[model samples]
Target: MVSFGIWGLIPPVLTITLAFITKDVMVSLFLGILSGTLIVAGGNPIIAILNLTDMLAGSLNDGWNIRIFLFCALLGGLVGMLSKTGSARAFGRWAADKLNSPKTSLLMAWFCGLVIFIDDYFNSLAVGTVMRPITDKNNVPRAQLAYILDSTAAPVCILVPISSWVITVMSIVKGSEGFSSLGISEFEFFMRSVPFNIYAILTLIMVLTLILTGRNFGPMAKSIKYAKETGKLYNEDYGPAPGEIEVEGEQNSSKARPMDMLFPILVLIASAVILFPMTTYLGAIDGESITSLGAAMGSMSLGDAFNNTDASMALFYAVIFTLLITYIYYTVRKLFTIKSASDAIGDGIKSMVPALIILTMAWTIGSVIKSSPEDGGLGLAAYLSEVVVGGGFPIALIPVIAFALSALISFSTGTSWGTFAIMIPIVMPIVVGLAQAKGLMDGAMLNSVLISISAVLGGSVFGDHASPISDTTILSSTGAGCPHLEHVATQMPYAITCAVCAFIGFLIGGIFLNLFVAWLAALGAFVLALVFLPRIYKA
Candidate 1:
């Protein structure tokens, strides 16, 4: 067994640098994995290449990983079916008829983002599609619409425990050595961390304040004034907004109903909710016969069942069943033939390929970083924790540090999930070590851990919101028919404002180790910005 020591940091640093430079995460991650395998392969390039392929294969070798992959692909297929069947456009038309004001149109977009919390990909694209027409009619700037979509997409997904983001994050956390040290289930830890996710909470608050109060700051203010006064949705200086490239030719566009979209999503959510407890109950039974659903459920509390649930499996099963029913539902409505439905589903799977590749790379790198030295890998978590603890690193400041660093990485890399993949594995062990060194109470240590974890989650969102190359950012712009750069520029002010508020919150929370006070302070700071920043900026 060989210790990599500081050398272990090379792969992540190289990955982050390359991602920032290339603005291409796939290539960046591949290179990063290749580098790590090189370290493990005794600096042999040929063997490193071999190890890289093996690592990628091994990432998908796990039951949990494959189920998550299938869930994501199936969910994508469901989204595709909705698009192919003109369900999204139908919902857009449905909302268009009732929304006469810009604020209301924007509010509807936010509402859609909230409801479509199953996946951020679906949220940004679907909400944008659903609200674009109404917002344009009401003279809302395309940039503003894009901002709202971007805000709601990832932030909302990260906050909700049932979403793909939660499953993915939990999957990553479940594998880390530090998670084992926490003495709680991954789901329970995630649930406890929610209120401490200050940036996401503040971002949503900022969006609502901007919409409800019709206040604006920085580039957004100018964008709003220009678009509303000129009846232009986007800047003419930037040329026509890019094509949305609708998935299918809305053949029955007029005949399509909003329920075509709504019912399937509802079924998916309902199925997952019900299955979570049942599956946990059944898993606990483990070969015992359960004759009655009521008796079995009554045996265990609902919250405990959720805590024990295999979230990835539950979501995968739920989406699988939802896809089957959705196919039959759409076909019966004459939205598409069996063959066309097949094609749409295939395309949807293809759409998820980029994300899947990122996930695969993320998982592979994470495994290498945490694998024991005897396993031909660097024990990064153990090594880094030792270094931080012994080096007199500020024990309480990790939450703030994690938040800022996660933001920088995510902003540079243009992917929050990727940042989570990179940072959480590293941050968790260091925070745990620091907490131990301080001789803190178990409850105090837990609060610190949750705050630190939430910092990583929230900070990644800040970077994602501001990054020009982010998938959600690009999708939000496309959905709203806004120029991508214009959207990024206009969204920067809001992202930064919320980030500052989140930073302050984490600062206080980190110093005092209090989730309650931190969140209240964070919210109050955002509220102040919402109240005074607009007046000051405009004046």
Candidate 2:
């Protein structure tokens, strides 16, 4: 193993710093990969370039990565079909009647986000598209819409039980030596850890608090004021794309009904929920003859059943099924001709190309960090864990430290999945080592483990929400037709406010080992912050 010692941190740090400075995610990621590869190649430029290519190729070739990429493309196509059918517009009109005020409109967007808890990417794009027209009509700023879309995307997914986020987390935790040796199932751990995910829970709560209080602060407040006073939804620097306006106008011209949009989404959700459990049960009974479905389900806990299920495969099947159903529904309703529907599908996939590219690069950088030293990978997790352990860092402070590190990493990288991939493996081992050293498992030590895991997830979401380079952040801006930098600026204060509360929650939870008490304190802190901070913006 070619250990880089503490030097392994330089690449990611450089990548993050440059991203903020240049405001170019692609270049930031590329240069970060190059820096890491150069260090691995002993400063040889040619080998470093070759290594970067190999790293990206390996990431693309991985089965899980390929599945997620395909899912994104297919989901995009489905959304495209929704747009082509005028379903989005119909839904917006229907929603406008029910949600008359700006506050209610924002809440409806947040509620839609909560309802579509399957995937964050889907959540960001779909909610933004459907809610943008309504919010704009209600005089809500595009930046505010972007903020609502972003806050609900990953934060909601991470908190929910049956989402892509949970599946990925369970899969990673299952593979960790700590959980495996302890005979603790990843699903069980995930369920137990949800409550301790203070950042995510608090973020969600903060969204509602802002909406209910009819409060907008920081840059968001100024943007909303401009929209209200001038009737311009976007800032001077940014407006809706030509394509977006054209689509909106086309949707207005079409005769599609609200069910046109609502039915397809309902079908998609039902199919996923039904198929996921059924497939999980089937996988659990592989090579065994279970005479009845009920018997098979009874044999395993829901967690175990889901644990054994191929989540990627389940989502793939669900998307394919949903697409077929959507096509049939539209054809039956005479909403569009076959040619138009097909064109929409193709266009939708094209729109997702940028997101897919960014995801691929994010995965590549994560792979580069985690790859073995023999493969010229930095093995960053192992190195960081070593540094933390050896540097006299206290074990009791792991949750808070992990929160800060994960936030920084995710903010820099703009990908929470990448942060989770790099952090979980590193943090679990450290937790195990600390637990063993303390000769504790069931009490405070176990709580620490749970809190630390939650901290990583919570912090990653917080960072992703705040970062301009994040895919969800970009998509949110696109969805709301807001300038990217404006979305980033307006949302940062809100995100930071929640994150501060979460940090305190983690600190209290770690010190006192009382999840309930810590959560209450954190919630109170958030409420107090919300009440006081808006007054500053008001002045």
Candidate 3:
């Protein structure tokens, strides 16, 4: 059953199709889960119920993965509250007033996307929502806005160190004996791999190039022209209609201030960066490494004097602090009434219900996949590695193949995290085996590991950016209110352009430089964008 690719995908495909047809993702995901449960349990009615229970329980117990969904839900609530408070509108007004040029606005969108790399979902949602109105006001199309958000999410995370995705992948890698014996720490190896992550580097370059060149073509070109001519992107009315802004904008309103918006966002980021590293540095942590929550927990424990009671509960503490601080600031600043805060939280949780359901189904399928090695499911990595090793394939092609595999699975599954979870574990072993066979030292083996991981991440993000059913795609479309298919159609070409060029760059980097250099060299795609963009738009 695990050997059947279609078997693994059937339930998810049916669910996604249903969602698209009904325009209800929640229903689609639920039905998908149900279908999987029924199929796996073989129609034993009681056992089917039991399987569903176990799936739900297992997902809840999955710790970080589940916690992330919860965190996203809370953030969603914050967004909702902020929306109702008109904080987003105020920021839009400010952005519109400050950044009057389309090029600058586009650059700002790209920059914000790059900087907000802590979590992909947050990147997709927050950045998309905040930037959409501003972009539309500046005559940027919704398809363009979706492209910006979709491009930044996985690509930036693949490059960053402290991201949740990195931590998760690192944990999985450390579980492998081959990885452990390599004597290369995960962070060190991850950094080395950064330059080899061709997809990320190239995407970043593409973003900058797009901003500088202002070239639009295909669906994007059409969308941009339509936006400029009709003055409607995603059918949205940007700001108050002309003279209406003079009337409505002048009312003495008690909406949330810009400070109210910036404070919580800053706190979330600071807590993750400062607290995460400090705790790890202080040595109160134990694991593969100290996570962001662990660091926050360590601070609370050591700072509390004698008891050190809060040490084990760092994540809980950090989450509470974030939620409370965000609520208090929003409430006191009149961003929302107290009742609104509570309602926002509830609404936020509700918004995340679909994600939670999907997460569980994904985990269930992942659990089945993880059990695959036991049943001779060496996975695609094993098969590809075997072919590459036997055929004496050039090292230059490793990143390309790995990236393509990641992209393929991610696009099919509509989830980057799932792609990472599936591919990294399998790819690490292949890298180690190949290194040993080639008489490479620990250092060379580590290089392979880094390169492989980079490829996986790059591919995963590339797929997510283009996949019609991807969560980020949905979120991007929802944020911009662009038709999902339209966004997907418009974005795929640009993403592919980066992918092909990045693949070439990766091959060159692998042949000449080490993995990191190869990945870094892919950043040259920005230059490619500069050279070709004018022609694209001109056409």
Best by TM-score: 1
Kindly state the number of residue pairs that clash in model 2: 0
Reference-based TM-score of each model: 0.95, 0.81, 0.72
Weakest 10 consecutive residues of candidate 2 by summed lDDT: 240-249
Tens-place lDDT digits, model 2, residues 196-280? 9999888888889888876768788888778878998878665343235334327433587877767877887788777766877
lDDT of 3 at 508: 65
lDDT of 3 by residue, 1-539 (tens): 32333344455456546644664544555565566565556557676667666765775575555555455456556545544555544555666678877788888778878866755666776666667768867778777877888888877876775454565455445444356667755555665677677777777777777777666666677778777788877533223211111101122134645455466657766665444444344445555455455564655643332222212123333445677888777666655667766776777567656655554555554443333434322233344445556666566566667787777767766767656655665566566666767877766666666776777888878877777877777777766667777787778878888887677665665565375566455656546665666576542
RMSD list, candidates in order: 2.0, 4.2, 7.2
Ranked by TM-score from best down, the candidates are: 1, 2, 3
How far off is residue 123 in model 1, in Å? 2.3
Instruction: List the candidate numbers ranked by lDDT, top first.
Output: 1, 2, 3
The residue pairs that clash in candidate 2, if any, are none
Off by over 4 Å in 3: 1-85, 115-129, 157-177, 182-192, 225-254, 281-317, 357-396, 481-486, 510-513, 516-530, 533-538
Model 1 Cα displacement at 514 (Å)?
A: 1.0
Global Cα lDDT for candidate 2: 0.76
Candidate with more favorable, higher TM-score: 1 or 3: 1
lDDT of 1 by residue, 485-526 (tens): 888888988899999999999999998899888987888888
Off by over 4 Å in 2: 1-4, 7-14, 17-55, 60-63, 117-146, 160-192, 215-253, 286-295, 361-368, 371-380, 390-392, 412-426, 442-446, 468-490, 534-537
